[model samples]
Target: TEDVEKIKPEFVRSFQFENKLMPSTWIVIRIDGCHFHRFSEVHEFEKPNDKQALNLMNSCAVAVLEEIQDIIFTYGVSDEYSFVLKKDSQFYQRRASEIVSVTVSFFSSMYVMKWKEFFPQKELKYPPSFDGRVVCYPSSKILLDYLAWRQVDCHINNQYNTCFWMLVKKKGKSKSEAQHYLKGTQAQEKNELLIKEFGIDYNELEIMFRQGSLAFWQKEDKNMPHESKGSVQNSHKKVIVEHCDIIKPNFWEAHPSILD
Candidate 1:
């Protein structure tokens, strides 16, 4: 029994590679679908924007936020999502592999579990998987910039896809023709095409399509009956979800606690 208690500690220590994220920093774990183009096609996702698929993704993200207390915020577009851990978090000792792997695995599982809820009529041909990576930001400014970059990318891609699908679905152009027509066209040109050809104003498009989805916690008070009749109990904090424009200064100002 004494020898069993004195077993070598190196046996466990050897398994770790010391891939720890820096302390006093923000940790971002981003997960993206692998070969999702084919997956989306197989699932018969609507062209340009699939509301059901996007909703499914957002639901999965909500599950992640509810499960992982350290993740203070999340931003997701298309088949990718970025989860931001609180700057002072010590989850899994800030081990990069452990945190990234577990978060992505949980997200993937939630996606599968909720798929039927999102798409009851459609059958899933195969399972889906996401690849994940971890990045650390030393300051709030850098993290803000990183999030802004993803929002900008969302805007650009949504604009292009909106035009591409318009040309294909409504205009009766083939996929290749739409691609060729969009080639070498600037954002201004795409906007003009949408306006002239499809009578669509790019700015008027849904914010969720142009700006992506932002998930964060909001504290609210819910009144409950106390032990005594007609007496109110104390309020507590609850995490709620929101989909809005995070690129604006107002959003950052409103949720100042997220970065802290």
Candidate 2:
């Protein structure tokens, strides 16, 4: 029993490495606002009235986790849920658009059944759309920190939209530069540059950007000020950026291939 306990974590790690190939990038799946408006009519009856809603939401989360078992290694839940995927896994190679498509379809089917079961008589009002962003990164630490930040944002904002961000390192660039590049600067020009350099269609790239998501920035604009006119007002913006790096993939290394 002691041996089993000691080896369990190691075994899990080994399995992940063997299957995922030491992930060169981080793949994040984030779900926001999974539960809302379970029971509105019975405001006085709290326990039994709300139980169904809680159960339905839990079931939906389970369904989502089960569906993505092949790709996700570890996950966490709150108002939002985040799943971290192994790098170099077949899942990472898939087009970002495909990832969102599959996720939406699965949620749609699961939610339909769950809603019907929970609210059979009254017309069910679906919660806000489960739109989310997907991001990939090269550093596990960065990805984990980003996930923590996302959860905090969701809790504070009371909004339903979710964002996924990934960090992928350029083959020969220093990690610091890669991190800066991933932060997304001059996104419009970057998008155009990527299209020109890679010969990928601009429209398709836009779709990938939609699925892959964007970065969040807290900005203090010179044009915008606080009501008092003495303090600076800061605005948060979510913007998507994509571009290639100066670093070239090693000829002998198996790097992630961009898919259409």
Per-candidate TM equals 0.91, 0.40
TM-score of 1: 0.91
Candidate 1 local lDDT, 41-157, one digit each (tens) = 999999788989998999999889999999999999999999999988999999999999999999999999999999999999999999999999998889989999999999999
RMSD of each: 3.0, 20.8
lDDT per residue for candidate 2 within 119-165, as digits (tens), equals: 57646654434555567776755764675465444332211111101
lDDT values for all models? 0.90, 0.44
Off by over 4 Å in 2: 1-23, 33-55, 73-79, 118-123, 126-128, 154-260
* Whole-model alpha-carbon lDDT for candidate 2: 0.44
RMSD of 1: 3.0
Indicate which candidate wins on lDDT.
Answer: 1
